[model samples]
Target: MHGKRVLLIVSGGIAAYKSLELIRLLTQAGCGVRCVLTEGGAQFVTPLSLQALSGEPVHTTLWSLTDESEMGHIALSRSADLVVVCPASADILARMAQGLASDIATTLLLATDTPVLVAPAMNVRMWQHAATRANMATLRDRGIHVVGPDDGIMACNEFGPGRLAEPPVILATIASLLAREPVPQDLAGRHALVTAGPTHEPIDPVRYIANRSSGRQGYAIAAALSARGAGVTLVSGPVSLPAPPGVALVPVETASDMLAACEAALPADIAVLAAAVGDWRVTHPGTAKLKKRPGQPAAPLSLTVNPDILASLSAPGPRRPALVIGFAAETEDLLANAADKRRRKGCDWIVANDVSLPGDGSPGVMGGDRNQVHLVTADGTEAWPSLDKREVADRLAARIAAHLAPHSLIRNSP
Candidate 1:
C-alpha cells in the first residue's frame, strides 16, 4: 500500500471512531490518508482528532475559499488512488446510490473517478430495510466495493447485522484494493454454485418453519467468488439480503426448491452448500391456513425428511463439482461434528463453526455476522480467528483459489 493515496470519507455514526484506527494503520503501511468528515460525522468525531491522527487538513465543507484555492473538491476527489467511505451511514449510502451531491462527501464521491469502497454501519432494522438493500445493490451494480457492516450489538441496544467491520478487516481490504498487481481473476471460466440463507418449510399458507440464517455469509462468499472472475450462481433461500454483484440469483423457499435450484446450476467447478436447510417438512402440507376452534385440541403435525442437498451434490457423479464444500453449524464438539459431517456428506472440505455462543450478546450464528470457523479437511483442522463474515468469505475464497491452482491439484482427485 506504500505511496497509495486514500480519500477517506467519514460519515456520521458511532463507528466514526474506528476511522482513527484505520488512518493509523494506513499511515503505518506507508500510505497517505486524507479525511473528509461529514456534518453528521462531526457530531461523533471531531476534526481536530482526525487531523491530529492524519497529520493533514480534514476537509469538512464544500465552499472553503482558501482550501478550494489550494485543493479544490474536484482536485481532491481525483488526488487519491481510491476513495473509501467508512462508517457509511444509511443517509450517505442512499445518497451515493442516488447520485445525490447534497454535501461535500457525496460531492467528492460523485466527482471521483477512482475506485470506491464502502464500510457500512447502521441499526439492524435500517440495514435490513428494503430501501437500504436496494441502494446497496445499486452501488454494487455500479462496481463499488463494499467491505462490511458486520452483525453485532449496536449502540441502540439491539443486536443484529449492522455494526461496522473491525479496523483490521477494513485495513486488509484497503491493502488488497491498493495492491500493485490487479486482484487475481483465478476463477475465470469456472462456474461456482453457492447456497445461502435458511430454507423455509411451509406447514400451511401462513405458517412455516425456518432457521435464523441471514444469508450474509453465503452472499459474501458469492460476491468474493465473483470478484475472482467466476461465473457464480447463488441459490438463495428466503433472505432479505441484496443480490451480490456479478452473480446469478435463484431465490427459493422450501428445501426441495433449493435442491432443485442447485441441481439446475450444476456442472459447476465448485459447490458450496451454506444454507441451513430445514431437516423436515410437513408430511402433508395444508392448502389453507390451519385454524383452531375454541376449546378444540391442537392439530398434530407430522414431518418427513427433506432431501440432503449436500450429500447429493457430493455423490460420485459426472455432474458433481470438482470441489464440494459443506458448512456445519454445530453447537457442541464443533470440530468433531464437522469432521464427521464432512465424511458423511463426502465433501472435500467442511467449514465448521460453534454457533452455541452468542455474538455481541446476540442469540446465535443463525443471524450474526462475525464467525469463528475451523477448516476441516482430510489432512487436519485449521482454526481461523473470529472475523467479520466478509473477511471470512475473502479468506475462504483465497484458499479455494490456491486449492484450484493447477500445481496444487496433482495431490487430489476431482
Candidate 2:
C-alpha cells in the first residue's frame, strides 16, 4: 500500500482519540493520511495532534480560505484513494445518510465518488436505534464499507455493540482494500466530457416538461471515466445526485443550457451524451403559473425543437472529440432505431436501451439501478447483458480506454 492515500474523517465520540492511532498505523504502513476533524471530534483530539501524527495539516471547517484556494473540497475529496470515517458517530452517520453537507466531513463524503469505509461508534442504544439502523443500511446499500462497532463496554458503560473497531483491524481492512486490483489508468492524460440527467423545459415557473432520468447511469459513467485517470467534465441537468469525485461538474437545467455547457467543455478526447434532453421546449413559457379553471379549456402550450446536442458535438471540427457516443432510449425496435440514431446524430457510437416497461412489472431502466443495453457502431451491434449501471459504466469506460489507447501513442509521439 505504499503511496496510497487515505482521507481519514474523525467524528465525535470517545473513540475519536483512537483515530490518532489509526492515522499513525496508516502512515507507518506507507500510506499518506489526511485528517478532517469534525467540530465534535475536536473536543477529544486537537488539530495539532492530528497534524503531527499524519504529517499533514488538518481540515476542520469548510471556510478555510487557504485550503479552498490550494485544494478545494471537491479536489480534497477525490485526492485520496479511499476515504475512511473512523469513530463515525451517530450524528455524522445520520447526516451522511441524509446527504447533509453542513460540515467539512459530511460535505467531503457527499462530494466524493471514491470508495468509502466507515467505522461506526456510539452508545449501544444509539447504534440500535431505528434511525441509525436505517442510516447504516442506506450507507451500505450505497456501497460504503463498514468495519465494526464490536460489542464491548462503551464510554457510557451500557453497551451491546457500539465500539469502534481496533486501530489494527481498521488498518488491516484498509490494507485489504488497497490490495485490490488497481484501476487501469489508460486514459491517464485524456479529457472526457459527459452530460447527464433530464433537461427540464419549463412551461411556467413551477411546471416543466422532463424525462424520468435519475442521472444514475451518466453519473456512473463519469465516475468510471474518472477512475481511469481521465479528467472529466460532467455537464449535468438538475438531479438529486452527488457529484462524482475527480470530475468537474457543470450544472444546468434546460436543454439549451446543457448544450452550452457541453460546448464549453469541448476538445475532450471522449464525449458521452447520456442526458435525456427534451426534444422540444416551450416556445414561450408563461410569465406566471397557468391557472386551472373548472369547466374551462386548457391553455395552449406551444413547443419548439431544442438544440440537437449530440449532432452539434459530433460535427466535424477541430474541437470535436475523437469518440462521440450518444444514447438512444427506445420503446421498440431498439437496435434498428439505435443504429439509425447513430447515423443521424453523426456520432461514432450509440448505446441503445429499451425504456419500455417490462411486462413483469419490474422497474424500467430510466430511473432504475440496472440496465440492458446494445452498443451500435459502424462495424456492428454488440448486446450487453442486464447489469448494474456501475458495471455497465466500467465496461463502457474500459472499451473507451481500448478505443483511445492506440491514438494516445500517436498524440504523445515526439
- Candidate 1 achieves a global lDDT of 0.88
Q: What clash pairs does model 1 have?
A: 151-161
Cα shift from native, residue 404, model 1 (Å)? 1.8
- Model 2 residue 265 lDDT score: 80
Looking at candidate 2, the ten consecutive residues that score lowest on lDDT are: 405-414
Model 2, range 1-414, lDDT digits (tens) per residue?
799999999998999999989998888889999999999999899999999999998999999998888657889899999999998999999999999999899998999989999999999889878788768755654657788889899888896888999999999989998888989989877888999999999999999999888787898899899899888999999997778767799999999999999988877889999999999999999999999999999999999999999999999988888999999999998898999999998999999889895732123457765688899999999999877677789899999999887785322100
lDDT by residue for model 1 (84-149), tens:
999899999999998999888999899888999999999999988888977876676455788887
Question: Best by TM-score, which number?
Answer: 1
What TM-score would candidate 2 get against the native?
A: 0.62
Score candidate 2 by lDDT: 0.88
What would the TM-score be for candidate 1 when compared with the true structure?
0.75
